[model samples]
Target: MSKVVLVTGGSSGIGKSICDHLSGQGFIVYGTSRNPDSLNTPELPYTLLKLDVVDEENAKQVVKSIVDREGKIDVLINNAGVGITGPVEETPNSEIQKAFNTNFFGPINLMKAAMPYMRDQRKGLIINITSIAGYMGLPYRGIYCATKGALALVSESMQLEAHEFGIDICNLAPGDFNTNIASGRYHAPILEDSAYSRNYEQVLYVVNKQMDDAEDPAQMGIVVEKIIRKKNRKMHYRVGAFMEKFSIRLKQILPDKVFNKLLLNHYKL
Candidate 1:
């Protein structure tokens, strides 16, 4: 039987690309969308399931449905997440809570739900899609970075804990990718009235430019496929533009002040 795989936020962007690529590679891939029917695309190769990762009950049912039919879930990709943009001070508590629920807690719920089955099978893979920003806080995207960073740390702990169970976990942090993420990002409504308003346009411009020049999302799909096929997968993988991936290494060697300066310069802060 083909390996069974589950991917969240599979309606579009990197999630959809991964589903298509893995399905072509002969995996029994199932992709989740908040509203799968909205896609209405006839060409998709993988199965679509309705899921809202923020809803723990729904996540459990989805996994149960998969395991019921497939007998085993070989891989779980926690890719469903939302983006928020604004100064941390200006972002509403509700927005921050919402981000945490979807980006961090949602993955936690799925992991908890799948662990019993995976542990019983004594083997499974969980891939958490994090971000290069998770390594450092970005100016306008502080909340988004925090969410990803939290998930990355959780994934690290999970890997260590699940090792004995014959399970593997990977935190894949990609830099900017050409996706519709920008349009979907939640912007703080107070930006116009805040003191930072004067420079907000410049910040927004830089952010948009980065996305426009971002690497192809399909590249991530290729990288994920390779990782899936590997026998001993690494715990962490970074994929994206050269600088974005290199920045992680640079932070390791550069002095705190030097790295901070470079980061501020990169963002024109």
Candidate 2:
């Protein structure tokens, strides 16, 4: 029997690539978008389900609907996330809350909804698409980093807890991918008199340039496919650009002052 795979935020970018790649591998893939009817991506070969991960009730309904139709969900990929960029002090609580709602809590809700089914089956895979930013704070994107960092921590605990149930939870952190995330990031208002206004623009400019030069999203799809085929997968996997993938290792070995300086230099701070 084919495995039933669910991928959120599948209308485009990495999610779309993953869905297409998995479907091509013969898995029964179902991708979700807030408005499936509005998506015109005919080249994507997978079932389209309506889902808004930020809504707890809606998330449960979508999971239940998938279970009803597919009988079991073998894999759940939490690829849905949003980006927010700005100085932490200037970023409004509301904007932070919105980013958390979509990036952190959203994946948590979907996992909560799907775990029972996974536990019952005694075998499943849960992949949370985090970011290399989760490993450290970034200038003008601290909040975004915080959200992914929180999810990465939770995923660690989840791996231990779910192991007894024959379920695997992995945090897949990618550095920078050629996706539409840059254009979609929420920017905190920079008032004319704001102290960080000038710095914010420069930081945002660098961030955008890095994103523009990011690796292809298809690379993530290939990595995910390999992960899915593994009998015993690692709890954490880091993909993407060379420095971004190596940064995690560097952080562990380098002194705080040195690592911090390198980070600042990379972002031109």
Q: Name the Cα RMSD for model 1.
A: 1.2
Per-residue C-alpha lDDT of model 2 across residues 206-248, encoded as one tens digit per residue: 8778876889899888898888889989989999888888888
Model 1: colliding residue pairs: none
Q: What are the candidates' C-alpha RMSDs? A: 1.2, 1.1
Instruction: Give one digit per residue, the lDDT tens place, for model 1 in 1-269.
Output: 79999999988899998998999899999999998877768878989999999999999999999999999999999999999988787788999999999999999999998998999999999999999999987788889999999999999999999999999999999999998877778987645568887555667779888887888899878998998889989989999888888988998999999998997787787
How displaced is residue 149 in candidate 2, in Å?
0.4
Model 2 TM-score, all chains together:
0.97
Q: Which regions of candidate 1 are displaced past 4 Å?
A: none
Instruction: List TM-score per model, in order.
Output: 0.97, 0.97
